[model samples]
Target chain A: MIRTENLCKRYSRVEAVSDLNLDVRAGTVFGFVGENGAGKTTTMSILATLTQPTSGRAYVGGAEVTADAAAVRRQIGYMPDVFGVYDDLTVAEYLEFYGTAYGVTTPVIEARRAELLDMVRLTDKADAYVNTLSRGMQQRLGVARCLMHDPQVLILDEPASGLDPRSRIDMREIVKGLRERGKTVLISSHILPELADMCDEIGIIAHGKLVACAAVEVVAARANGQRQLAFDLLSGGQALAHAFRHERGVTDVLTCNETSVEILYSGSEEDQVALVRGVTLAGYPLKAVREVGASLEDLFLRLTEEPVLPSGA
Target chain B: MHNVLRGWVLHNPLLHKELRQRMRSGRTVLGLSMYLLIIGAVAFVFMYLNVQGQTLLLQPARTAELFTFLSYLQLALISFVTPGVAAGVISGERERQTLSVLLTTPLLPASVIFTKWVTSISFLSLLMIMTLPLYSIVFLFGGVAPSQVLAVFILQLITLGAIAGASIFWSTFIQRTGWSTVLSYATVGGIFLGAGVAGYLFDSLSTHMPDQGLWSMLSGICYTINPIYMQAALESSRGFFTPTFHNSLVESVFQTVKTHNLTSSGSWMFFMSVYVGGCLVLLGLCSWHLRPGTFAAAVRRFGRWLVR
Candidate 1:
C-alpha cells in the first residue's frame, strides 16, 4: 500500500530522513515507533507529499509521490500531529469543507457527513463550533477528515500523542475498527505496547534509519530466547526440580522456595502443556503453573539500546 | 458550457470556506459599517460646508468637486484596507498549522492563491459597492458623466487588484502575518506616497532648469511612473474637475501621448495598464513562493533528465 525506496530528506546540515525504506502491505496496520526527532514525521510527510524528499523516491498504491502527487494524494489520507481546525466552522461544515476539497459532490458529502460524525461520535456536536470541542473530539474529527474520502491508505503521525488515557483508548479502538474495515494504516507513536497490540507489523526507526522491522510475534520471540515457566508445587520441590532438570526441554531449573520451582524451558507451547500433564501423572502434586514471555516493552528497550548505524552503513 | 461553469464554481472549496468564515465572523459587518461611516461622514461634511446657511441643494460644480474628492478618498481607502485584508492570507494559515493539511490534499497551489485573491477582492468590492449611493448623489447633479464614473471604477478595480496582489506576495514570502502586513503597507506607501513625493521634488527642481536639461527628463519619467500624479493630471485636464489642481510633470506625459493623437480615454487606458500588469506580475510571484523548493526540485529533475 505504501513504499519508500532509500528515501532521504536533508535540511541543510541535518539529515531528517536518510536511506530509509519501508513496505506496508495492504489491509494491515503498520505501527512506526521512534523517539522524538527520530524522523518518523519526516518520513510520513514525504509519503503524504507535503514535503519533497531531498533524494530517493516514495510511492502510494504504485504511484510515485513526486511524479504523480495528485493521484498519490487521492489515495492517501494524512493527519499531521499538530493539525489546526477552522475555529469558526461547525463540525459538519468543517468536514464538508474537506469533502469539497477532495472534489466529493454535495450529495455524497451530505450522506457521508452523517456517517462520519456518527463514527467519530460527534453527531450531537454537528452544529457546535470546532474550537469549542475538547482536544480528544478534535483529534477524532481529524481522523474523520482523513477518512472523508474513503482513502486507501492512512498516514497518521502521532495520532494518539498528548491524549488522556480514555481518549487514547478511544483512538486505539477507532484505529482497530479501521483495520476491521480492511483499511491500511501507517501510524507512528512513542507508545510501544499499544502498537504491539494493534499492529500486524512494527518498525523501529532511529537516527534517520530503520533499525528493526518485523511482525509482532517475531519481535517478541527475538526478545525472549527461552520461555520462563514457574510451577507452584504442593510438596516434593526437590524431587520435581530433579525431574525438571532431567527433562528434554528444561535447560535450567531453580528452587524458588519450598513450595515453588522455576524452569527456563526451551520448548513449543504444546510441549510445555504436555510436560505439565506428565508432571501431574508422575505423582507430583501441582498447585499452579504459568509461562512468561518477554513483553513488548522489554523488546522495545532491547532494540532501541542497540548502537545505531549511520545512514548507508 | 453549463457543466464547465458549474464545475469551476463548485470546485473551489477554499473560496467557499473563506466566504463562510468571513461572513460568520463579526469582522465583515464591523468593517463595512465603519467604511460606510467614514466615507459617509466625509461626503456629509463636504455637503455641510458647501451649504453654509443656505438651504441644501446640489450644484453642478460642487458635484464635480465632490466626485474628485470622493474618487481620491475611495482610492486611498482601497489602498489602506487592501493590505489588511490580504496580508494574512497565507501567513495566517501557517500560524494556524493548516497550510500543511491543505497542501496535502489534491488542492493546487494556484487554487489556494486564486481563492484568496477572489475572497479579498470580494470583500473590498463590497466596500466599493456600498458607497454607490454617494456616487449616485454626484451623478444627480450632472457634472460627471456615467462613462467617467465607470472609468473611475475600472481604475478602482485595477488599484484593488494591484494592492491585493502585492499584499499576498508578501504574505507568501514572510513567515509571520505581522511582518507581511507591515511590508505590504510599506510597499503600497512607496508606490503611491513615496512616488508622489519624489515626483513633486523633481518637478520643483526641473522648474529652474533648462527645458532640455537632464533634470527635466528625470522629472518627466517620475511623473509618468507615479500613479497618483498621473491620476491627478488626467482628472485636472477634464473641465470642471479639480480646476485648481495642476501637475505640470504629469501634464507633460499627457501632452506627449496627445502629440501622438491618442484620445483622453486611450491615454488613461495606457496608464492603467501599468497597474494591471504590475498586479499580474506580483500574483505570479506569489504563486511561485507558495510552492517552496518546487522550482529547485524541478530544475534538478530537468538537469537529470537532460543528462540521461
Candidate 2:
C-alpha cells in the first residue's frame, strides 16, 4: 500500500536519503532495518507526509503523498521514533484528543477507546496520567494512539527500540495482531531478531540505500552459501575428519575434541545424506548430523558490510 | 464548508483540554495571578490618587473621562500581555512534539491556527473581564459612560487578537518555545516602542516650527498609517488624557478631510477594523509558515543570503 520511486531528500549540502525505492504491500509487516543515519526516519517522515521530499515521488494507498497529503494522512497512521507524550493528560484523554483529530465521532471514539486500551493492555492505566507510566507503557499508548482511526497503514519508526524483553515481546505480539487484522505496517528497528520474528518481508538499509530486501529466509539463504554441520561423535573424530577431508562438498572440517567435529560444506540435502552414509560406512559411530541454517543476525551483518568501490577508477 | 465546520467542532475537545491544562499549570496560573495582582494594585493606586485629588471626584464628566482614561491604559497593558500569553502556542506544541499529531489530522491549518488564537486570547480576555468590577465601581461614582467602557474593552480584545496572531505567526518560524516567546516579546515591544518614538520625534519636530527635516515626511506617514496614532487621536477627542498634537501643515496635509469629521466611536471603529485586518494578515502569514515546504526552504534561502 506504500511505494516510493527513487525518493531523495537533501538538507542543504547533505543528502539524508538518496535514491531510495520502497514498496510495501497491503496486509504485510515490512521491516525497515538500518543502522543509525541510514535515512530510515527520513524516508518514513516523507511517507507520513510530515516532511516533503526534495525530489522523486511517494504514494500511500494509491494517492501521491505530495499531491494528496491530507488524503494520504487520513489513510495512514504515523508514530515517530521519539514519540513524546503529553504528561498531564490521562491515557484515555490522550486517545480522545487524537480520536477527535482523526475526525472520529465522539461516541465511536469512546466505544473504541476501551477496546484499543484493552488491546494494548493499558486498560487499567486509562485513568492514569501518561507521564506517570513507564516508558514501555507510553510506547504502547503511542501505538494505541495510531490505531485510534483504524488506519489502513501504520508507519511506526522503532516501536520496539527501548522496550525491555517482556515489553518487546508484547510489542511483537501487538504487531502480529495488526498483521492478522490486515493492516500494513512499516516498522524500523535495530533489533533484527525481533523484526525477523514479526515481519513478513524485510528491507535492510545502509548508507541511505536499501542494500537488501527480500523474505527473511531468502535473504538468509543468499548470505549463507555453506551450511554448518556439527557432530558429537561417540568414537571417531580423526577418522571423521579424514573422511570429510576427501569429500567433494565438504571443504573445512575441524576436530573440536576427541569425540566432536565441525564441518563447513556447500552441498544439497542429498550430498549431506551421502556424507552421513560415508561416515556410517567408515565404521565411526555417528551420534548427530544436522544442517544449521543462518540466523537473521548473521545475514544482517553480511549484507550491511561497508561498500568498497575500487580505487581511483 | 461542512468539513471545515466539522473540523472546527472537533477542535473543541483539544481546545478545552488545552485550556484545562493551562489552568492547572503552575507557571500559567502564577503568571496570570501576578498580572492580576499588578492590575489590582495599579487600580487601587489610581483610585487613591483620584480620591486624594477630590477635584476629579467632584466633576462627573471628568470622572467619566478618568475612567475612560484608565480603561485605555488597561488596553495598553493588554497589548503587552497578549504576546506573552500566545507566543508559545504553536512552538509549545512543536516542543512537545504534539504538532505532528495535530497536523496529520483532517483539521485544516487555518482552523488549528484560529483555535489556538481563540484559546490564548480567551485566557487574556478572562483576565480583562475580571477587572470589570473595578470599572463598575468607577461607574458607580457616575463618571464613565457604559458605551465608552464597552468600546474600550472591544478595542482591547481586538488588539489582543492582533498580538496573539503575531506571536503565533512567529512561533511557527522558531524551533524552541522559549526563543519564540522571547522573539515575540521583542517583536511586539519593538513595534510599539519604535512607532511611539518615531511618532513622538516627528510630532516634536513638526510642532517645534524648525526646519522640518526627515520628521516632516515621517509625520505624514505616521498620521495616516499608524494605528496607535489613530487610537490616540480618537481617545484625545473623547476627553481622555493623551498628548495633544498641534494642528500643523503635515496633519492637514495627510489627514483625510472626511475622517477628520468622524465621531469618536467612528474613529474607534476604524482603528478596530485596522487591528482586525492586521490580525487576518498575520494569521495568513502564520498559515503560510505552517505549510509543509515553505518554512524549511525559506530558512535555507535566508541562511544562504546571510552567507553571501
> iRMS for all predictions?
1.7, 2.9
Q: In CAPRI terms, where does candidate 2 land? A: acceptable
The lDDT, on a scale of 0 to 1, for candidate 1 is: 0.81
What is the Cα-based TM-score of model 2? 0.85
lDDT of 2 at B233: 53
lDDT of 1 by residue, B1-308 (tens): 78644544566788889999998888789999999999999988977787576545656777777787788899889989999999999999999989989988777676688789889998999899999888898877678887777767876777788889889989998999999999999988888877657755766777776763666555555555555655555555544354322557545645543343333554456556667787777777776677664555567779889999
Q: Give the 10-residue window scoring lowest on summed lDDT in candidate 1 chain B.
A: B254-263
Cα error, candidate 1, residue A244 (Å): 12
Q: Number of the top candidate by lDDT?
A: 1
DockQ, cand. 2: 0.40
Error of 2 at B168 (Å): 0.6
- Looking at model 2, the pairs that clash are B64-B143, B64-B144
**Residue A151 accuracy (lDDT) in model 1:** 94
| Chain B TM-score against the true chain B, each candidate | 0.82, 0.74
Model 1 stretches astray by more than 4 angstroms: A223-293, A309-313, B1-10, B56-58, B201-221, B237-240, B244-273, B292-308
